[model samples]
Target: MITTKLYNRYQTVIPSEIRKKISVDPDSIVEWTINEKGKVELEFRKRLTEKDIIGLIKQELPYNSVEIKKRSGRGLDWE
Candidate 1:
């Protein structure tokens, strides 16, 4: 297991190997959780952007203008 020293400020750098594996970089949100079994888990949270949403629609959603209109309720209108 990889180990790191906690500094005076209670801060520790994540190991480079682990960071690379998780695709974490500067400005990434880090999440910490402690389970009932006393196991601690660290995770990197990825925030979705507008570009990501567009890409998801392009890739996964089929063109359904009627369903889109019903679900959106004038949201797509340019008023």
Candidate 2:
């Protein structure tokens, strides 16, 4: 079992090996919650902002003429 000590500020390092295995980076946001068995659980999640949406639009994607026609109010059979 991995062991760690609480520092004077009550902060503890999650151990480099464990962090590497879990793919967690420094200063990454983590959520700690308790499960039904009172076991601690950690989850990594990133919040999306307006900038993220713009970046998604800038990213490469498949073309969709059907969607374009529908969006333009054109009569296009989409069967």
Candidate 3:
């Protein structure tokens, strides 16, 4: 298990290997919560925005252009 000490009020470096295993980035906003036993933990990151989703899709499927599925009952409305 990795042991980390909290120092200075606003500066802490989560170990690089841990960050890589968790796929966390520098600008991520972390959420901390305490369990019933008073042990604090960081929750999973937030949901991705539409742009984030698109970016991930492109990263995974670089050769493919995504096709949008329009809502049902939409009748030829192109503006």
Candidate 4:
């Protein structure tokens, strides 16, 4: 098992082996979780950008500004 010492501020450098295996960079996000058995887990994810979520919302109908204004007048938000 690879081991590293935690500094006074509780910060520890990730070993090169682990870093290479996970392919994490400075911009990567690290998620920490504890299971029922109290085992800690680490997951790495890429940071999200506007381009990544541009089309996340599915559109079934065509866009209509008039319909949007009417819906807004009726207090409907994104129906």
Q: Output the number of the lDDT-best candidate.
A: 4
Write the residue-wise lDDT of candidate 2 on 3-73 in tens digits: 99999999998888888887876657889999999999989766544334443454366646456545446
Off by over 4 Å in 4: 54-79
lDDT of each: 0.73, 0.70, 0.63, 0.80
lDDT of 3 by residue, 1-79 (tens): 8867878796677888888888888667789999999999886575554345544543443332233223222443433
The digit string of per-residue lDDT tens for model 1 on 1-79 reads 9999999999999899999998887868888999999999877978754434543544453555555555566556432
Task: In model 2, state the lDDT of residue 76.
Answer: 50
Off by over 4 Å in 1: 48-79
Q: Measure candidate 2: CA RMSD.
A: 11.3
Model 1, residue 47: distance off in Å is 4.0
Q: Candidate 3 regions off by >4 Å?
A: 46-50, 53-79
Residue-level error in angstroms, candidate 3, position 22:
0.6
* lDDT computed for candidate 4: 0.80
Could you give candidate 4's per-residue lDDT for residues 1-79 as a string of tens digits?
9899999999988898989998988888889999999999999999875456446768897776567557755888773
| Candidates sorted by lDDT, best first | 4, 1, 2, 3
Residue pairs with colliding backbones in model 2 are none
Candidate 2 Cα deviation (angstroms), residue 26: 1.5
- Candidate 4, residue 41: Cα displacement in angstroms equals 0.8
User: Local error of candidate 3 at 27, Å?
Assistant: 1.8
